[model samples]
Target: MTDYTSMANGGLPRISPYQAGKPIEEVQRELGLSEVIKLASNENPFGMSKKAVAKCAEALNSSHIYPDSNGYYLKQKLFEKFGYDPKTITLGDGSNELINLIFQTFINNKVNVVIPAYSFVVYPMEATVADAQVKTIPLKDWVIDLDAVYDAIDSNTRMVVLANPANPTGTAVNINKLKEFVKKVPHETLVVIDEAYNEYQKEEDFDDTAKWIAECPNLIVSRTFSKAYGLAGLRIGYMVSNEEIASLVNRLRAPFNVNAIALTAAIEALDDTDHLKMVVAENAKERDRYVKYCEDHNLYMIPSQANFVSIDFKRDAFPIYDALLHRGVIVRPLKGYKLDTILRISIGTHVENTKLFKALDEILKSLK
Candidate 1:
């Protein structure tokens, strides 16, 4: 038989699979734990809105039909709720898929992509997968170095990614700073902002990229139902850009790329402002609690506007993470992000937060 693996593209073998936060079932199966509180994946612990649930059930009746290829009703709702023109929207299976789609449409071996380092892992991964030239610039003080990013751009640069309220670290730059960076970018180069946690940010912290696209035609802002809407299982997200960019990007999208159930859930989830408000408000409370805990205990943590906090454990975070797992709690360890001493903890409900700290205290005691 032929060696099929050797026949594949050289870069195909180099891709590392994404590590999602452990599922509740996986923990139960592996450890036989019944009462697990997972704060690993920045999930909405409050669960989805009742309105979205009802819409999902209604969508089941028409399960035999294909989803609307353009996500018409969802886009219509988005236009009404957010006031963006329909021509500016491009729907995807998730913002992850949208990220891939954007690269697929613009990238080639001839041009390079400028990745904002320690941001989303997918940005660099996709650039590598496409065999596009990749240039990575590291963070300064755990925040994206926009000045360095601007300096890296050249005639060969096709795209530059900026993750607002960046993942893992969960820090956001101010609006004026963001505008200064965007204004400096070349008009021909695409500037993409991954805003998965935009809804979780305070009004003052948010840059409102939805409004920015109108004036900056080269901008593409991607968001998901997975974060604040509690629809990760549904896998729906959308991209916002000017008509020209969206039109080009949509050409590369597959028909019925988004499922009917996800569409229904996202559409109804928009109207559940009360449910969204509750989720964001609860997240803010837990985030503040963790910040205070860090201050009182002399533990260092990033001041986050996103739904999670990154704590510096002053040593390897893996042992703490494993100990927490054994105690029926789960939090993220950032070894993959090359921060072995830092653990990123997603905001949970009041009960879940209490359980996590209790586990941490016990584990730290045992280790000492």
Candidate 2:
């Protein structure tokens, strides 16, 4: 047999794959636990909207038919909501695929992508696979340093990816600061704002990148149905940008990239305002409760506008993470993001949160 390693692109050789949270069934199998509460992945605990569920069921009956290549109905709904032309929208399997498509469209061996040192890892990983150099700007107080990012940009910089309410940290840049930063960036460089958690933000002053897209021709705002809409399993996300940029990205996107059921469900999800409000309210209450719990326990935690909170253990988080898992509570350790002392916990139902707190209390007591 031929050595396929040699046949592959040498520069793109051996990339580390993303480690998603362990499934409940897998954990139950491994630990022999009956009940498991997953406070990982920042998923909506309430599950998907009823309207979306109904729409998905209707679409599933015709699952044999191929999905619309253009995602016409979904795009129309999005157009009404955001008032952007259908030409400006490009749907993806998820926002992650949209991220890769952006890189594939513009990035090459010569161009480099700039990302925050502690921002989403996908940007750097995808850039590496494209054989493009990656410039990582260190975080300031667990938040993205817009000034530092601007300083890092040079002539070879092709794209800059910012995850507002960034993962693992859950910090966000306000509207004014983001606008100033956007104004300073070179027009030739594409600024991709990944707003996957946009629905969870309670801040009145949050950056509205969608409005800025009209002014900044180089800006792309990507949103996902995974978080607030409770459609993570369906894997539907879309990008809004200028027609020219969207056209470039569309060229690289596969036909029927989004599935038929996902498209129908996402359209219905958009109309489910009551479900969205309930999710936002529940998440807010749980987030505040978690923050208070951390405070009472004297655990340091980053202030978050997103659904998850990054709690500092003041020690290696992996051990505590393992302890929590053994207690049937699953949370994410941020060791991969260089914050070994922090664990990111997604907000869950009241009972689930209480169980997690109880587990943490027991583990901490044992450690002491």
Give one digit per residue, the lDDT tens place, for model 1 in 1-368.
99886776635567888899898889988999998888988888888899889879988999999989999899999999989888899999989999989988998778899987788888888888778889998888888888899999999999999889899889887778888888778889999999999998879877668788767888999999999999988899999998988999899899899999999999989999999999999999989999888887678998888888999989998999998998888889899989999999988999899888888878877888
| All candidates: TM-score | 0.97, 0.98
> Candidate 2 — number of clashing residue pairs?
0
Q: What lDDT is reached at residue 318 by model 2?
A: 93
Please report, in order, the local distance difference test score of every candidate based on alpha carbons: 0.89, 0.89
Tens digit of per-residue lDDT, candidate 2, span 1-368: 99887677625675788889889998999999999989999898999889888878888999999999999998899888878789999999989999989988988889989999888878888888888888989888888999999999999999999998899788887768889888779999989999999888866747568779778888999999998888889898999999999999999999889999999989988998999999999999989998899899999889898989999999998999999999999999888887899999999988999899999999999999
Counted clashes in each candidate structure:
0, 0
Provide the global lDDT of candidate 1 against the true structure. 0.89
Best by lDDT: 2
Clashing pairs in 2: none
